[model samples]
Target: MDNANTWFDYIPFNSRGKVGKISVLLLLIAVGLSDFVSASILKPYFERLRPSHSELEGLILLVNKGGKYGFVSSHAANIFAASTILSFFYIHKKKLCLTIAFLVSYSRIYVGVHFPGDVIFGGMLGYLIAIITITFYSKFVLNKNKKKLIG
Candidate 1:
């Protein structure tokens, strides 16, 4: 487990084992793909604007293009998705993963790209996707180890 932790931390620096590298790559790809699909497919359908562009006009701190749709924040969705998957692999560091997830989601609103509601919804969607993926992986890929541990 210590080796796994070491590898996890060093994966981006080219000091990780093959499994760790593969895990990180998969997590990134999954999150990226999900975020892209959510933004492209769902954002247009929802077509909601940020608070800065809404009736709350002066209440929001406008820093960017505020009139654009902001239903599902891509930043929030992608980071949440990555964090969720990391949490499953780093169960002992669950709190850290969650904290990072919160920060990532909050950054979207702080940067004026999305509303609070957008981050909230995106995080939820990301979490659901992570749960489904993790469940499938555990049930199939880790089934043998699970039975052995249980038995």
Candidate 2:
């Protein structure tokens, strides 16, 4: 449980079958890549300025200054993507994960780096990407009966 330890200890390797594990792993990868694409591509495309970059009158800077553009918050997208992926496997903890995602997204706005709309859009982008990933994962990756995955 030490922070210094590697992340392999956290993967649910034993409980899930081979395909299930593969699905989870791929889900993680896809969500991560999706968030990266959103940040790398969409931010520059939108050309929205961060509050720090803009000379606002009363903007309280909580965190350090970020890059030039900040249309969609990358932090929000990444965290929400993780929450969505986790929610697929852990139905019981959906609300908790969502709340955590919401709070994390809100932090971006609270930090004055991104607007409320930016965080909201980032969260939606993550969710939509996750939804697409899970749909493909469910249809192709999971086995018959639609409940579990088998190798």
Candidate 3:
């Protein structure tokens, strides 16, 4: 949020053990999937224009305009996916992770790139993807290991 580079900077280094490494990998995959879904799939399907491109009467551009379509913000989707995964790994840091995601998502609106609806839907989509990825990881990776240990 405050610094764009800090999102996944220290998490990988700080995380410990096999689970931590796998989680970091999965988190990266989640972010990639969110971005791909938002930008490549949904954006093309919806074909909504960015507010800057729409040319509203009093719209002030704080940052350079983005691509043509803005149905779902990739920034929101990626950050939310990262935040959701981080929260799963560090339950105590959920607030910080969510706060970062929210701030980054809001920045898109602040800079006049995406509509509120776009950001909201992107965030929801990212959260859903993260939930699915986490469920699969737990059910397949963690549970299988547990079963082996028990057996």
On a 0 to 100 scale, what is the lDDT of residue 42 in model 3?
97
8-114 in candidate 1: lDDT tens per residue? 56334343675566457657766866677678888889988766667764565646664478888777777777878877766776788789889988987886777
Runs off by more than 4 Å, candidate 3:
1-9
TM-score of 3: 0.91
lDDT of 2 at 20: 53
The predicted structure with the larger lDDT, 1 or 2, is 2
Q: CA shift at 43, candidate 1, in angstroms?
A: 0.1
Which 10 residues in a row give candidate 2 its minimum summed lDDT? 4-13
Candidate 2, TM-score vs. the true structure? 0.80
Point out the higher-scoring one by lDDT: 2 or 3.
Answer: 3
lDDT per residue as tens, model 3, 126-146: 999999999999999889999
Best by TM-score: 3
lDDT of 2 at 116: 88
Query: Which structure is stronger by TM-score: 1 or 3?
Result: 3
Q: What is the lDDT, from 0 to 100, of the residue 22 in candidate 1?
A: 49
Backbone clash pairs for candidate 3 read none
For model 2, how does the per-residue alpha-carbon lDDT over 1-151 read when each residue is reduced to its tens digit?
Answer: 6673454544444446765576478667756776787778999899999888988998789889888888888888887777888788877778988999899999888888988888888888888888877787778755455555333
lDDT of 1: 0.74
